[model samples]
Target: MVIFGGAGDLARRKLFPALYSLHRNQLIDQRFSVLGVGRSERSADEYREIVRDSINRYARVDVEDEEEWSSFVEKFDFVSLDVKTPAGYQRLREAVEERERRYTIPGNRLFYLAVAPELFGPVAARLKEGGLTESDGWKRLLIEKPFGRDYPSAEDLQAQIAGSFKEEEIYRIDHYLGKEMVQNIEVIRFANTLFENMWNNRYISNVQITASETVGVEDRASYYDRAGALRDMVQNHILQILMMVAMEPPSRLKPEAIHDEKVKVLRSLRRWRGDDVKRYMVRGQYTGGYLQEKEVPAYRDEENVPADSDNETFVAGKLYIDNFRWSGVPFYIRTGKRMEEKATEVVIQFKDVPKNLYFNKTNDLGPNLLVIKINPEEGLSLQINAKKPGTDNEVVPIVMDFCNNCQEESPEAYESLIHDALEGDRTFFTRWDEVSLAWKFVDPIRQAWDQEGADTLTFYEAGSNGPKEADALLIQDGFRWHSPYNPRTGSVVHGSPIGD
Candidate 1:
């Protein structure tokens, strides 16, 4: 493995920790090793110590055995070089060759580009020029997110990288696809008779996919201000989750088959333009407020952000898949920073019964929901109507829940993705067409926002759910966002009852 940004925060916080956990679990072979490439000046021994510190601090499993720790870190080597210049590629190549010889390992290469998006093309080009891409074994390239600012840029990046790697050899990593519950979506649909029969517009009412964060842009103002919520979250992570939830079952459980189904979902999305953009999308920025009783700055007040910036911190929108299976079903997606709780969940709200047998006594009954919890907690909860234990006819919503990670911790997203890349499995990675289609669907919204500026942008309190217009986006359709889970009560507080 060759990590491009060896000394950066992503390397320290995620990459090293994931690699250490993989090593600790004995998932990788003994011949496996890492060659970290960066511009930071550090010897191999010094880099090893840095990795040791990162593993001790951030790894899921602790370092309990001194001998094992020593053996694992010994295989790591570092080379300091300017990634932009071709002169440093020779040194990097030499270091890689020397490590393969020392470990008596085959020349399989996995180059991880963890640097800025601007460097992705330059680094790949340099590697090709230096003859480091050719090897005795298979080679792969793992690219980090924000593939491009938009469709054109992403297309250009693909063209540039095509010089060094083929489409089959490239892995576009989206961590959300590796989540436990997200992966379970396929199983819950295909493996279960109950769900598979009703996973369509006939039995399902609406699907809400949310990826919210209780955080403001802390140190990423430069990036966040430019990317905003739409480009940052919606274009990649949220859309990927939507694909998993709504895709048709593949003919076979192969990477190509899965990709084919997912791309169809993207292709079926209804294109929004002109007045539809305003009617279907709601964008907002956050203002100063208390979060968990502690005061926090607004998006504009954050460091490096312009005072009058129109970049959206929150976005809520309705999407339609103009296909037979999901013709009239609405897929609502919303994501933002510094709002409410930190959760990534998909709520599959099933249609109400044809006859209201219990409505006369109970006034209203909650919609049956199959909620898939993805982050902060991994679980599944099904909400159903039941009579109160002591009452004859009083009906209430009750939950049957299954917690996925209550017993033991699940593997981190990076861990699963890295392992798959090493084993040459592209099951969870996004293909080029998927990325391009997502950008095509998202580009019009961005262009509209740029044209209208702050006229279309709204503001919400930092700790609040989001702009009222967001709720109105659904209320206008006679639907509402599902009430979030209440930690103290261990139940989902019911929102407005679904209208007939």
Candidate 2:
């Protein structure tokens, strides 16, 4: 494994720790080795010490075995060489070749790029130019998020990497797909007899996908100020999850088949323009607001953010499908930073009763909802109608929930994903076609936002739900935001939760 920017925070905080977990599980052995590459002038032993400290700090150590830790450290060595220059590529090639001979391993290589987005192309060019990716064994490339600042740049990046490896050789990591709950979306829909048939327009009314964060962008201001919620979360994680939820049942469980169906759903999305942009979507930038008991600064007040920055911290939009399965059903998506609560979930709202015998009476009874919890507390809950506690014929709402992770400790998102990468399973990874199609669907909205300007980019206070425009988008369509202000109780869930 060649990590281009091994000295970076992503490597130390996420990659190395994930590798440690894989080592702990004994999934990777001496047959595998990690080559940490950077331009820094650090000796191999010095880099190993840095890795040791990082693993100890970041990894969730169950055994805490000194011997095991040492063994893991021994498998990792650093190479200080520039990825852009020819001489630098020579050093990397020699180091990898020497390692392969020492371990008597085939030339299979997993080039992991944990570097800045701008460096991705140069690194790919150098790797291909140096013939490091040429071998009988498989050559794979794992790219980090921020695929591109926008659509055109993303296409260029793809063109850059595809020059080195085929589309199959590339794995686009969403991290969300690696989550135990996210993967369970397919299982919950397909494996169960109750949901598969009703998972369409007939029984379902709406779907909501919400990914909210309580903390502000502390140090990520530089990146956050540029990408915001749409590209950072929606284009990849939200869209992928939505595809899994809304895609038709695949003929087979192959990754390609799954990806094909996802592409279909993305293509089916109803295009929004003119009044629809104001009615179907909303954007907001958070001003100075209070977080918990302490007052948190606004985006402008953040260290790297400009005072007049137009970057958005919140986004909410409503999307529709033009196909038979989801023609009338609307899918609402909202994501933001510095919200009242930190939660990620999807809600699926079922159609209202055909006959209202009680004549719109108010009580604990409510619409039947299937809520899929994606994070914080991960699980599945079904809201069903039952006989009221005392009343004879009156019905009330009760929950039949199956919390998958509550029974067993949930695995970390990266833990499961990294395992799949090592095991050569791309089931949870994104394919190029799906990525390109998703970009196609989202590219228009991004272009419109940039060209039309922020006349529509409203501002909201920090720790608020979102701009009123978001609420108006839904309220005008007979819906509202699901703001869980208090974590202790369940709120009325109208917006689709899991598949919503």
Candidate 3:
């Protein structure tokens, strides 16, 4: 494994720690080696210390044992590279060869780009031009998101990498897909006959997938300013989740077959144009307010952000697929930062029953709900009408919960993704087709925002759900977002099953 930008925040914060966890779990063998490449002027021993400190601090598992520390650090090494020059690539090649020979490792190589997005294409091109990619064993490239700023840029980046490696050699990482619960979407659907039959427009009313965060852009002001919520969240992570929830079941569980089904979902996405774009998509920026009971500044007030910046910290949209199974069904997605508790979840609202047998209930008997919680807490729950605790036989909503992460700690997203990459599993990685189609769906909305300007860029309190317009987007359709905050309680609300 050769990690570019080894001393960067992502490398120190996520990559190294995940690698350490993988080692601790014995998922990786001693014959494997990792080479950290960066411009930092540090010796191999010094770099090893850096890695040791990182693992000690950020590793998911305890790695304080002297023997274990020594054994793990022995396979760790570093190389200093300017990244732009041929000399840097040559030096990287030497370090990789030396480490492979030392550990009797195979020619197999995994290149991870944990550097800035701008460096992704150049680094991959340099590796190929430097002959580092022409190994006797398989060579794979695992890249981080922000694949491009927009559709054109994403296509260009794809073309640049295509020159060096084939489509199969690239692994596009969306860490959300690696979440234990997210991966279980397939298992929960296909493995169960009940869900398989109801997983369509007939039984399901609407699907909502939200990934909200409580922290504003602190250090990523430069990137976030340009990317905003659309490119940053909706384009990759949120859309991928949508596909997982709405895609057709694969004939088999193989990677290619699964990808094909997912691509079909993307292709079937209903495209909006002209006035419909503004009607369906909404954006917002956070205002100074409290979060976690502490005060914080607004998005515009954040350092390095322009006072009048129109970049959206919040995004909510109504997405539809024109496929036979999902036709007329709406997929509502909302994601933002500094608005609410950190939660990632998928809520499937089943259509209401034909007739009501009970009367005088505390609240309206709502549609059945299947909630798949993805983070902060990991679980699955189904809400159904049940007999109230009285003899009158009134109906009330009750929940049956399956807490997936309650008994044991699930592996971090990076841990699972890294392991899959090493095992050469494309089932968990996004292909180029998915990427291009997602960009296709997102580009027009971005262009519309650009051309029409930010006159509609609304504001919401930092600690609240989002701008009121986000809620209006749902109300306009005669439906509402299933509150992901506390689905177990009576706070969950349902609206008309057939949307306006």
Candidate 4:
């Protein structure tokens, strides 16, 4: 495997750690070799030293094996070459050719772009131009998120890379799709007859996917300022999750089949335009406050961020999929930075009974909920009507639990994605149709927001749920977001931070 930008923070922090785990598990063998390519002046040994410290800190090591470490280090080598220069490409090509000859391994190169988004096109063009990827085994490219800022740019990016690699050969990855729980999303909804029966507009009242972050934008402030919460979080992550929940059942478990279904949902998304955008959407920014036992700075205080920036630190919106399965149902997605608690999960709110026999019985003890926990902690819990303890004809909500993470070892998102790439499994990768539909659907809200401007970018203090706007978003519909943190009890009328 040829890992581009191997010395960068992403490569060191996530890519190396995941690859090491793959090695330790014996999933990869001596036949496999990883070439770390970057624009750095470092020898093979020097690069190994850099990787050794990274693996030690990030890898989940077990069964102390010195020999294993030594053997893994043997695969750790580097080629100092920038993809920007022609000479650099030649040098990189020569180094990879030698490795191929030495190992007698098929050049099944997996070009992973671990660098910044701006460099994605250059590296791709150089790889194709240098003829480094022309060899016997399958060659593939795994590109990361922020596929594009919007519709036109995303389409342009697709066109630029299409010349170098075929659509099937190019693997566009969304890490959330690689997640253990996220993968099971398809199974949870389809494999089970119970979930399928109640997944329609009749039983489900509202669906909420909240991805909160407790930390502020300490780094990447420039990027966040331009994209904000909607472009960064909603356009990709939240929409993807919504598709997982609301997509129609596929006839087969094929990549095209899965992606086709998702695209349909994106097409069916509620059309928010003109004045309706502000009515359905809510946006906010964080004020200065404390989090994680320390005083932290606000968005303005962050480096690279403008003092008068109107970019939103938070966004909460309601999505109405105009389909038979989800006509009346509303999908709510709220994401923000530096609020209070750190967590991520999905809450499926079921419709209330025409006459609540339980409301009078349990003193309005909240409606029944079927929550699918995604991260920080991962699990499943369903609320059912039950009789109150030591009561006659009185009912309350009780939960039945299934925690997937407690007993099962969930593979990291990168592990699943990288392995899928190597095996040529496109089931987990996104298609252009999916990407285009997502951007097109989000474009209107984005345009509407940009047109009106942030006349009311409410500011929420740190260690609180988002601004009152987020609450009012759901309250207007006579529903509430279930606080996954306090699921054992119920939704907290109190505040909590953003994360996942």
Give the number of the best model, judged by lDDT: 1
Tens digits of lDDT, candidate 3, 146-255: 89887888999999999998999999999999899999999999899999898998998888989999999998999999999999999999989999888898988899
Per-model TM-score on C-alpha atoms: 0.98, 0.94, 0.96, 0.94
Q: Kindly give the stretch of ten consecutive residues in candidate 2 with the minimal lDDT sum.
A: 491-500
After the best TM-score superposition of candidate 1, give how far the Cα of residue 360 lies from its true spot, in angstroms.
4.7
The worst-scoring run of ten residues by lDDT in candidate 4 lies at 491-500
lDDT of 2 by residue, 321-356 (tens): 889899899899999988877888888878776443
Residue 64 lDDT (model 2): 69
Better of 1 and 4 by TM-score: 1
Model 2: residues with Cα > 4 Å off, grouped in runs:
358-364, 390-394, 483-500
- Model 2, position 285: C-alpha lDDT score: 85
Off by over 4 Å in 4: 356-365, 407-409, 485-500
C-alpha RMSD for every candidate: 1.3, 2.9, 2.1, 3.4
- The clash count for each model shown is 0, 9, 0, 7
Give a tens-digit lDDT track for model 4, residues 17-103.
Answer: 888888877776677778888777888889888888888787665427888887887777898876778778887788788888888
- Model 3: how far residue 466 lies from native, Å: 0.6
